[model samples]
Target: MRPDLCLENAGRRYGLRGPWVLRGVDLTVAPGRLVRVEGANGTGKSTLLRLLAGIDAPSEGRITGRPRTAYVPERFPPALPFTAVGYLTHLGTVHGLSRTAAARAAGEWLERLGAAAYADTPMARLSKGSSQKVAVAQALLAEPELLVLDEAWTGLDTDARAELERAVAERTAAGGSVVFVDHDPRRLAGLPDTTYAVRDGSLVPCDVAGPLPSGPHVTVEAQGPPDGRLPDDVRRTAASAEETGPGRYRLTVPAPHSDLLLRALLTSRPPWHVVRVAPRPDAPGSSR
Candidate 1:
C-alpha cells in the first residue's frame, strides 16, 4: 500500500546556494504508524514539518502523503480562552468540516484536553499550558489522516501530556498516522513505531539502546528533589544510559536525543529513578 507520508530525497536551504538545511531525506510514515524526526536546534526539524504539512514545498524532493495533514509547531500560536473553541471551529471549517461537525469535533477534543470547561473563555485569559492545549486541539480538530507534531507538548502540564498520549493512541489505533518531531522519545513511552535522526538533510535510524529498536540511550530524571518536583511543562528533560540490561523497560525515541526532551520536561518532573530508564545497547548510527 502507498505510505501515508513519504519524503523522497527531500532537500531545503536557507539562502541562495549558501547552505542547505536539509540534504536528502527518504522516509515513509504509513497509516497506523508514526515516524518521528529528531535533530538539534536550527536543523530544519520545523522546516521539514512545514514541508510535510503542505504549508510549504520542499526545495528539491517530493513529499507525498494523504491530501490533508496537520502540523503542530514548536512555538505554539496563542489562543485566548474566549476564542479557543471558536478557533477550533474556524480551522475545521477551513478543512471543510460543517459548522455542526466542527462544533462537535471541537467540543469533543476540547473536553478530552480538559479545556471543555473553558470552551467559551477568551484566549487572552487562558494559561500557557491551557493555550498550548488549545493549539494542540486546533491542529488535531480535523482528525486528518496524517498528523505532524513538532513538540506539540511544549507547554503542556503532566495531565495535558497524558491527554496527548491518549489522543495519539486513539488516533493511530483507528488507522491514522502521526509524524512527531520532538527532541526526546522517552516522553511518549509505549508509543512511536519508527524514529529517524535528521542530521544535515539526512534521515538515518536513531540507535536507541536497550530494547529500543534503535537510537541513543537517553535518561530523564528530576534535577533536584523528586518529591518537590515541578510539572513536565515547567522543567521538562530526560537522559539515557550506555548500558543495556534484560528485564528492563526500554523504549525508543527518534533523533533529536533524550537530553533535549529531558531539559524541556524538567518541570514535568520526569522519572528520576534509574529503574524507570532501561539501558541501551548502541549509540547513533548502529545497526543492531
Candidate 2:
C-alpha cells in the first residue's frame, strides 16, 4: 500500500530573511486522490507545487512520505540535448524500469500523446505544443505514485488535453495521487477530490459546493478475484462500492472516472470481470 504524503506546517522562502512564499501549509495527499491547486498569477501556486514535488526544500517545517514522484513544470526546458525518445527512455530507466521496458513505455506514451512522429526529433527543434506533449509523456511513462503538474495542459491541443485528463483519471484509479494546477476554471471541474486555493501565502480549502453542478455518474457491476477481494485502487476510486453477492460488487463513480475504473479492474494482476455498466438515471443531464 502506498503511504500518504504529509506536509506539516510547511514553509518556504528564498533566504533566511526572504519573505515566505508559502507558510503553515498542512496537507495530506493519500493514494487514489486527485488534488487541485488554484490561485491567481504570482500567488505562489507554482512554488507550492514545486515544494510538493521535492524540487525545493522548505525553509521551515517538514514534508514526509513522498512516494515515487514525477513532475511537469510550467515551463519545460526546450534546449535539452537528447531526442524526445532518448530523453524519455533515459528518464524511464532512472525511474527503475529496465532499458528495454523503458524504451517501450517511452514509445507508448509518445503515441498516446499524439507525438509519435516526433519520436526521434531533437527536443530543441520541436514546436511548443509538441514539446509540451513530450513533457507530459516523460512524467507519465514511469507511472509515478505521485504526479505533480503545473499548467501541464497549457500548450497542448484539444485532443491531447483530453488525453491528459484520461491519464490523470487512470493514475488515480491505479492508486496513485495527482496534484495539479491549471489555469482554466473548467479543467476537470467536477472531478477533483479536494481543491485548495493559495491565498495570503497559505493553503485554503475551497468550498466544493460552488457554482458547478455535479456531473453525471455511472454504475458498474463487477466480480472480484478468486478470493473475492477487490484491488485497493478500485475500492478507492469508486464513490460507493457495495457487495451485492459473494464476490460480486456494484460500484458507482463519476462518469469521467468510470472508464479508468473498468480499465483498472481489467488490468489488475488477478483481473476483475465487469458484468455491466450503465448511466445513473438520476444523474444530471441523464435521459430518463
Q: Which ranges in model 2 have alpha carbons more than 4 Å from their true place?
A: 210-232, 235-257, 265-275, 278-288
- In the range 1-288, model 1's lDDT, one tens digit per residue, is 335678899888866676887878787777767567788887778888887787777788887764467778777757434488898898889988999999899999888788898788788778888888888998788877778888988778767776786566545644677778766556554345676777766778875444433443543322334233333222211222222333222223333334334433332334333334344545433222
Rate residue 18 of model 1 by lDDT: 62
Candidate 1 CA-lDDT value: 0.65
Q: Each model's TM-score, in the order given?
A: 0.69, 0.84
- Cα error, residue 260 of model 1, in Å, equals 29
Error of 1 at 276 (Å): 25
lDDT of each: 0.65, 0.87
Best candidate, lDDT? 2
Number of clashes in every candidate structure? 52, 0
Residue 60 miss distance in model 1 (angstroms): 0.8
Q: In model 1, which range of ten residues has the least summed lDDT?
A: 233-242
